[model samples]
Target chain A: MAKEPEQEFVTMTPQQKKARRSRSLALALALAAFVIVMYFVTFVKMDPSILNRAM
Target chain B: MAFVDKSALGDADFRLSEATAADFVALLKPRVMSLVVFTAFVGLAVAPAGMNPFLALVSIVAIAVGAGASGALNMWYDADIDAVMTRTASRPVPAGRVTPREALAFGLVLSGLSVMTLGLVANWLAAAMLAFTIFFYAVVYTMWLKRSTPQNIVIGGAAGAFPPMIGWTAVTGSIGLESVVLFLIIFLWTPPHFWALALFKSGDYERAGVPMMPNVAGDASTRRQIFVYSLLLAASGVLPWALGHASAFYGVGAALLGIGFVHYAWRVLAQDPADAGMKPAKALFGYSLLYLFAIFTFVLVDHLAMRMIG
Candidate 1:
C-alpha cells in the first residue's frame, strides 16, 4: 500500500547538531563513570572462574 | 464506543488498517529475526555445559528483544530511505503506524531491558555480549557501514553472527574456541546469502542510494564475490566436525547443505543477468535461509544426541 510521500530526510540545524553532539559526549562520559563505579561495587569482588566450570 | 458509532469512514478505512498491520509487522523484519533467533537458540542449546533452564529461557528472550530493538532502531533511522525503496516503503515508521520518535524510544527501552535483565538472570558475560550485539547492530551496522561501502553487509553480518557466541557465553560465562567457530560460520555465510538478493534487487538499492554490493561493485563482480564467499561458507560449516564441536551427523548434514549453497551460487554466477529467468537468484535467496537454519539445527540436535548416548 501507499505510505509516506517524498519528504526528504530532516537535516538538523547546526546549533541543534552541536548541542546534540555535546550532549551525547557528556552522556557517554557519564555512562563510563557509572560503569567504573559499578565495576568496583559489584564486579570487582566477584571471581571470574565461577564461569570456567560452566565452560 | 463513540468512535465506532461515528463510522463515517469507508471500506477503504478497513483496508488501511490491514495494510498498516502488515507494515508494522514488516518493521520487525521476521526473515532476519528468524535467522538470528534460530542460530542464537542453537548456540544456547548446544553449549558445552548445560545452562539452568530458567536462565536459558531468559537468555533467548533477551537476545530476541535485543534483535527486535535493533530492528526498531534501524527503522527509525532509515525511515527516509525506507520511504524510497519499494521493498521497504511500507515499514512501520515509513507507513506512519509508528513514528520515528516512538520507534526510537521502543528500541532504546528494549535494548536496556534486554541487556540488564540478561545480565541479572544469566552471566554478566552473556549480558555484556547482548549489550554489544545491540550496539553492533544499531550503531555499528545501521549507523555506519550501511551507508559507507559495498562491503556493508559483509562487516555488518558480524552483528548478526554473534548470537551463537552470546549463547555460548550465557552458558559458560566465557568465550571459547567452539563459540568462535559458530561465529565464523555465519560471518562467512552472510555475504553470499545477501549478495544473491542484491544481485536481483540491484535496482531497488540503487534507487534508494544504498551502497549494497551490486550497487557498488557492479553485477559481474558481485556475483563472482558471491561464489567465492559461498566456497568459504562451505569450508567453515564443516569446522564443527573437524574441531570436534559436533558429531558425524552435523558434519555430513552441513557438508550437504554447503554443497547446495555452492550449486545455487554457481547458477547465479553463470546465468545471464540480462535474461528473463530470475529463478536462479530467487532459489539462492530461499535456500540460503534454509541452509543456515539446517546447519545450526543439526549442530544442536547432534550435540543433544551425543549427550544422551554418552
Candidate 2:
C-alpha cells in the first residue's frame, strides 16, 4: 500500500491579509459605536432626579 | 448555462478570500436601506409626539440595521437564483465574495442586535414591528412567495411598507392613521414600480425561474395591471390630504406627482411589443423611484408648514 502524503497549510497573500485586517477594524469600530450608543441611551432613559440627587 | 455550486467549492479549490469591507456593506443592500431610513425618518418626523434626538437617532439606526439584516438574509437565500440573474449576478454572495454561511451569520447577528437595541431605546411595539418586517421579508417573501407566485411583489410589498409604521410607533408609542396612509402609498406604488422593471427585465427573471408578472401573466396583462395599479397608487398618494392629515399644498403636489406617474404608466401600456426596447417601462421604473421620494418630501414639508402655521 502507498503511503498518503500530508497536506500543507496554505499561506494567505498580502491582499487577503490586508482584507482581513480591514474587516477586523470595521468590526471593532461597529462594536465600539454600539457601546457608545448604549451608554448615551442609558443617560437618556434615566430620571432627571437621578442627576439632581443630593450628594 | 453552467451553474457553479458555490457551497460545494472547497478551500482547496480556491485561494484565501480577499473579500473587503465594501463587500460586506454591499450585502446590506445599501440603496434599499437608504429608502427605508428616509421613509422611517419621515414617519418619525410627522408623529404627534417628538422623540429625544439621541433616541430618534437610535431608532433610525436600529430600523436601518434591521432592514439591512433582512436584505443580507435575502442575499444568502437567493444566492443561487441571484447568480443567474444579470442584475443580481454581481452581488457579494453570488459573486463568491461572501460565503453563504458568512452571510447567514452576519444577518442573524445584525437582526438580533437591531431588535434588542430598538426595544431598549424605543418601545417594544416598534421593536416587535421591526422583527416582523425582517421575518416577513426574509422568510415569507424571499423564501416562499417570490419563486411560487406572480403576485409576489403585491404581497411582499408589505415588508417594505412597515418601516413608516414602526417609526411612528417609536415616537408616539402607538400606530397612527397618518402612518397607515404612508404605508398604503408605498404598498400601492410597489406593484407598478416592480412590474415595470419586470416588463423590461423579464428575461433575467425568467432565466432565474422567478415567476414575475410578465413571465406568468404575459406582457399585455402585466401592462394592464400596471396601468390599473398606477391609478390606485395615484389616488392613494393624495389620501393623507383627503383624510385631513396633510395640507392642500401637499395635496396639490401629490396630485401632480400622481398624474406624472399615471402618464408614465400610460406610455408603458401603449408601447408596442415589437419595439423590443421596452423604453417606456424603463422610464416608468425610473420615474416611480422619483415619485416616491418626491411624495415623501412633500409629506415632510407639509407637516412642517402645518406645525408652523398652527
Candidate 3:
C-alpha cells in the first residue's frame, strides 16, 4: 500500500496563542526583574571597605 | 509558518484549561502565607537590631515566597489525599486547576528564587533558615510524617514556627532568646490548634487516610492532648513578657489571650465525644487563629511603640 501525506495541524486557536504569548512574556519579564533585584541587593550588601579598596 | 507534528498538535488540542493567575495564587496557600508573613514581619520588627526598610521588605517577601513554595510542593505531593479530603479537595493541584508537574516546577523555581534572593539581601543564616523551613515542610512533613504518623502536625509545626526566627536572623544575623520564644509560642500552640480541627474533621482525615491525632488515639485522648498543649502554649505565650523582651502591656494582653485559649481548650476537653455540634472544638479552632494573630499584632505594636518612644 502507498503511504498517505500527513495533514497540517493547528495546535492552538488565535486567542489561546495570544494568551500563551502574554504568559511567556510576563514570565520572562518577571525573571528579568528578579535577576536585576538580586544584583542590586548584592551590590548593596558589598563591603564598603572593599569598594574603597577597589577605588 | 512553523511545522508542527500531528501527534504534538493532538496533544495540545486535548490540553486541559490553562491555569490562571488565581490558580497559581491558590497553589501558594495564601492564607498560610499571610500568617507566615505576619509572623516573620513581627520577628523582623521586634529584633533588637534594626534593618534597612527596603532590605527588610525584601527579606519578608522572600520568606513569604519560600513559604508559598513549600505550600505548592505540599499540594503537589498531597494531591492524592487532598482529592479525597473535603477540606483540601478544592486546592489547585487536587481540583485539576493545576497539574502536579506544573506545581512541582513552580515550587522548585520559587524556592530557589526566594532562597537566593534572601541570601543576597540578608545574611546567609536567614536564607539557610528559609531553605530549611521549605524542605522541612515539603519533604519531612508532607512526604514523610503526614502519612506515617498521627503526630504529623506536632513535628510539622516547626516549619511554620521558623519564619520569625528567620526574620530575626535577617536582622541580627543570629538566633536569640527572643526568636526562640517566638518559635516556642507557635510550636506549642500547633497541637492544640490543629487537634481542635481534627476533633471536628476526624471523618475527613479518616476518609483521606491521614493519621490525625483524633483518628489514631480516639477523640478523648486527642482532646486531652489539646488541653495539655494549650497549657504549654499559654505558658510560652507569656514568656516573652516575663523575659523582658516585651512590655508589660504585651505581657498582660498575651496572658489574657493565653487564658482565653486555655479556657477554650478546657471546653473542648469537657465536651462529650458523641456531641454532634462539636461546638467547643469548633470554637477553639476559630479562637486559636485569632489568638495567634492577636499575639503577633501585640508584638508588632509594642515594638513600634518602643521604637517611637525611645
Candidate 4:
C-alpha cells in the first residue's frame, strides 16, 4: 500500500475567520448590486420595439 | 487531523488581514465623495437637456464612485505623508487598518468599474472625463504636484472641479460654457479654501514635508494670495448670470455668497500674525465649505425655479 501523504493546513484565528467571512459577504452584496444596476441600465438602453421584432 | 503548517509558509505571508468594511469605506473618503456627488448633481440638473431620472442617478453614482476611487489612490500614494499628519494619520493605509497594496487594488478596481459603468450607461465623453479626473487626482496631483510644489492645491483642484463638467457632458454629450463656468468656480475657490486650512495646519504640512502654500511661502504671502483668489472666486460665482445662463435670482445669491467669502478671506488677510489661535484662518476654512455648498445650491434651485416658471 502506498504511504498516505500528509495534508497541510494553516489555522486561522477567530478574528481572521470573522474578517474573511465579512469580506466575503460584502463582495457578494456588491456583485448583486452591480447585477441589478446592469439589468436596469440594459432595460433603459434598449429600444422600446426591441421585443416587437418578428420571430 | 491535517498537520499544521507553521513552517510551510512564513509568518508574514500567512498572516490574515483584520481590516473591516469600515476601513475600506474610510479609504474612499466619504465626506469628499459627498461634496463631489452634490456638485455633480447640480451640474446635471442645470444642463439644457434633460436625462432619464434613472440614467441621471446612474451617472451621479458612477461619478461619486470615481471620485471615491481617486481618494483611495491618493491615500495609497500619500500614505507616508499621511502617517505623519494629524489630520490624515488615522486614514486606513497610514493607520494600518488596510495595507497600501490592498488600498491600491481597491482603488484601481473601483476606477475601472466606475469608468466602464459610466461608458455603458451614459455617453463615452462623460466616462472619459471621469477617467481623466481620476488620473489627474491620483497620478498628476497626488503623486507629482502635491509633493513637489506649493501650488499643489491650485492644480489638484482641477480634479475636483471636473465632476460637474462630467455631469454636464453626460446630459449634453458635450462640454458647454455653463459647465466650464461651474468648473471655474470650484477651481478659483480651491486656493483660498486650502490656504486657509494650511495657515492653521502649517505644522502638519511641515512635519509631513508637503509644500503647502503657508509652509513654502510666508504666512503673509499665503494670506494675500488667499484674498486675491477669493476676489476671483467671487466674480466667477456670479458668472452664470453675467453670461446669461442663470437668472438674476441666482446672480443675487451668488453675489451675496461671494461677498461673504471675500469677507472671510479679508479677515484672514488682516489677522495679526502673533495670534496663535489663527481664528481668522479657521473661520475662513469653515465658511469656504458653506460658500461652495450655498453657491451650488443656489444654482440648482435657480435652475428648477426657472424650469417651473418658463
TM-score of chain B of each: 0.91, 0.95, 0.95, 0.96
- How big is the positional error of residue B102 in model 2, measured in Å on the Cα after superposition? 0.2
Give per-model TM-scores.
0.78, 0.93, 0.90, 0.95
For model 3 chain B, the run of ten residues with the poorest summed lDDT:
B1-10
DockQ of 2: 0.34
Docking class of 4: acceptable
lDDT of 2 by residue, B33-70 (tens): 99999999999999999789989989999999999999
- The sequence of per-residue lDDT tens digits that candidate 3 reaches over residues B1-310 is 2245454445544453467666777888999999999999999988998788878988999999999999999999999999998899998888886778889999999999899988878889999999999999999999999999999999999999999999999999999999999999999989998999988899999999999998999999998999999999999998988998889999999999999999999999999867988999999999999999999999889879878989
Kindly give the stretch of ten consecutive residues in candidate 4 chain B with the minimal lDDT sum: B1-10
- Candidate 3 ranges with C-alpha deviation above 4 Å: A1-9, A13-22, A25-29, A32-36, A39-43, A46-55, B1-17
Model 4 lDDT, full chain set: 0.92
What residue runs in model 2 are displaced by over 4 Å at the alpha carbon?
Answer: A1-9, A51-55, B1-15
For model 4, the superposed segments whose C-alpha errors exceed 4 Å read: A1-8, B1-14
Clashing pairs in 1: none
Better of 1 and 2 by TM-score: 2
- Candidate 3 C-alpha error for residue A13, in Å: 5.4
lDDT against the true structure, each candidate: 0.80, 0.94, 0.90, 0.92
Q: What is the lDDT of residue A21 in candidate 3?
A: 66
Reference-based lDDT, residue B264, model 1: 95
Evaluated at residue B181, the lDDT of candidate 4 is 98
What is the lDDT for B195 in model 3?
A: 93
Estimate, for each residue in B165-249, the C-alpha lDDT of model 4 and write its tens digit: 9999999999999999999999998999899999999999999999999998889999999999999999999999999989999
Quick one: best TM-score, which candidate? 4
